[model samples]
Target: MAAPLSLRAPAATPRLPRLAGTIRQPLLGAVAVALFLLSWWGATASGMVARLFLPSPVEVAQATWRLLGSGQLVAAILASSARVFAGFAIAALIAVPLGIAMAVCGPVRAVLTPFISLLRPLPSITWIPLTILWLGIGETQKVAIVILGCWIYILLATHEATRRVDPLLVRAARNLGAGDLTVMREVILPAALPGILAGLKVTLAIAWSCVLSAEMVAAHNGLGAMIWEGKDWGDMTQVLVGMVAISLTVLLADLVATRLERALLPWERHRRH
Candidate 1:
């Protein structure tokens, strides 16, 4: 017979190189930003839109520099950032433990679930008037707004994360003579950490937005207040500068959280790779 066809598996196709997880991805992101700037510059240069409505990127940059030189940008950033972190920290301290308790205790869940459900859908802005009335237009009110905006979401996320812990793992720990607290401390908490961290990252963003809203309405200084002032004066450049500052701050916060998540859950990172 024709020397019998060689019995062998087909050769696998060579995989194409991917840009993902490579330096090229960041380079490509830079390229995209450059293109956007170019287009924006072109639009402004060509007079496609009124400069009054949309200031050029250079104008926005110069405005940012002016604010920085005057120390206004720095102060606003510090004020807003402080409010965000303060509220977020307070929420985390309460919500995380409460969430864990709800997961582990039936009575706790029964007591909190209805209230969470009732209040979770309310937007942070809805609380502004009430907060001003109750807490006065002060830092306390701003921080409380952030807390009200973030805590329920954090609690819900923690609850879901706790619930998702595999029952088998808990059982195995218990069978090894672990008490409920031991099981929770050693097994459940680690398992739920990733989800909890992700939730915190999201809640941080929400906190920022809430603080901005609070500042816009009540505060004398903050990026949000800067934007509001700019709007009142019809200074598009100042408004754009505030917008950029907020965007950059949020981006940096997200990056920090992402790095922390990777550090805490190296196994998850490796598994994905």
Candidate 2:
């Protein structure tokens, strides 16, 4: 007989490096962004771009730094943020309950569905003329703009998520003696939390966009107004600085939303539960 077969199975490839890569990639990306900004600054400082239109990175940084050092940045941030929050809060307040009620009640759903269908596709900007007519160029107008911008998205998200709550879960809740309020609170909300929260994230971002639209019309004090003023004055550095500030604010808002989701979805966090 030939020598006994001595072949062995191939060893498994290591997964640690792949796992590490997942974490390393974002870190590398962040580092790359910082490096890019640094290089951009160097180029600008060296007069790579015309100062009028494309201000040197250093000039933009200086403008931003000065704004930050003063309270102007803070005031603009607060004003824009307040508009966003007020509008978003109003939409959420109305949408969530309305969505749940409509999903659970056919007659109510029939009554409202037509209106939501008609209104949702109309751009928020389209409402600006009507809103200004109704609310005028005051805080009311700004809030209305934000509201019009965000309301449809919030309503749709809430309605769809509510409607799509798993039938099995609803049945299970009924079988277990859960009532409407309890079922909604315990089963439906939890089940739809992820989707609803996801919608909030989207709406919040849109709220940011809407706030800018609201601010640009005639607001004396907002980041949006700041940008417009900067442009009119040919202060490209300030304009770019405003853009950067908005971007940073959006990123920070995303971070807060993520943390809020993680905190609220305890069952999601603990999969075993």
Candidate 3:
């Protein structure tokens, strides 16, 4: 007798390997950090590298504590953080609008593209001498360097994001009797926001790096200045402490950016899931 189709057993399906647990992510990160510290300690303890060349983690901790007690570390952090915030904020304000304009207007793009192409290839460090020449060794010079370093990247990212926005959504908004401004504000901006936010996060890191280069040239108080002072005095521990502070600050900033991105782009998160 022929088996009824409804009662027939289904063909065996292929089973994929189970994905790793979410908890494994944080566990692995912790394990990696612990291993790195252990290796560093082992190297220093075993004298694989001289203490002068590579200070022990314990020595760096001690130096950090000493700096904190003296309030120098806190002050340096504040100064550098302020510069990064100021520069990044200003760049975003200018770049965001200009980038959108460039994406929408051919004339604007034609005018700016050449200059951007020429300058974008140059590293932030290359601007130090020119900035010093133009703005002198003042806070303005440092801020200018950061602006130059970050604004181009922010502009490019925003332009690409704006251009990549789905045209169908724009057309639908227009067909629904939305004006150009309405379409832009309601449809375009929101659509491009995820990319814009991602670009800003990258620009923030570039701003930090530029600030360090600026401070290296001429600055009285900043993490970069602290590092330079340490180098001058051959204090590897102090340099290590400054480096650690920079790394921690950048990590904290990135964490905040991630939270902000998730909050601002809930749709993106939902889509990803």
Candidate 4:
């Protein structure tokens, strides 16, 4: 405080760390993955890891290459992707309207809540027995499982979001000569969109998992079937590759959803920092 050399000394700025925080986790993750692969290769070579149970990274890579070249993997991937899209789209279409209806019609929500609560906890696999009996073991049944998986999650999310949207916005809209439909369109939907999108993002991953499970039986082609067949033959390499593909696919989907959320919810984002 005593050393005032200049009338206007420059403001001091904190120096940035040598490593950026954003990339620190990614770098660490890469190193950890590399070490895991090295250890896996060593264990397989040393006979500590049985080939039937655990395959080397190189073996999994070779299996992936072979599946790709054979075109079987392509067919499986396409079939699974199609089922996922169809089911997920149907779920969104159904859930959004139902959620809105529940929000607007209090009695309707009260009536449905109990039934939905009962069903929501049930897993997609549990529905297989009933679905098979109700519907044939075909694309419809497979798609149904995915829809069942997606619908409840989106519905609950939408309902919660709608409830969370400020009531003052609705009152303001009504004060300005807005009808119920107008209020919903102008206030409720827009306000709840971010949460709804987040729910959809979560459901997309669930739908993928459901579709894989659905493909376990009766499906001639799909990633789940491929994995099942691999397991039946004790081909751990192929099983590992398929599992990796599924995980990577879900991660890519999550990334896309995050990007979409960022694009759509820019206002919420700006408020954060």
The top-ranked prediction according to TM-score is 1
Candidate 1 per-residue lDDT, tens place, 1-273, comes to 578787899997655455344767889899999999999999998999789999999999999999999999999999999999999999999999999889888999999989998998999999999999999999999999999999998999999999899999999999999998899889999999998998999999999999999999999999999999999999999999999999999999999989989998887896655
Candidate 3 per-residue lDDT over residues 135-197, each given as its tens digit: 898888888888888999999999999999999999999999999899999999999999899
Instruction: Report the CA-based lDDT of candidate 3 relative to the real structure.
Output: 0.91
Query: Taking the candidates one at a time, how many backbone clashes does each contain?
Result: 0, 0, 0, 0
How high is each candidate's TM-score? 0.91, 0.85, 0.90, 0.88
Q: List where candidate 2 sits over 4 angstroms from the true fold.
A: 1-19, 38-49, 270-273
> After aligning candidate 1 to the native by TM-score, how far in Å is the CA of 269 from where it should be?
3.0
Give residue 159's lDDT in candidate 3 (0 to 100).
Answer: 99
Cα lDDT for residue 200, candidate 3: 96
User: What is the Cα-based lDDT of residue 90 in candidate 4?
Assistant: 97
Instruction: Give the 10-residue window scoring lowest on summed lDDT in candidate 2.
Output: 264-273
TM-score for model 4?
A: 0.88
Runs in model 1 deviating more than 4 A are 1-21
Q: Residue 54 deviation, candidate 2, in Å?
A: 2.4
Query: Please, what are the lDDT tens digits per residue for candidate 2 over residues 138-220?
Result: 88788888888888788788778888988999999999999988998888888887888888899899998888977777688
Decoy 2 TM-score against native? 0.85
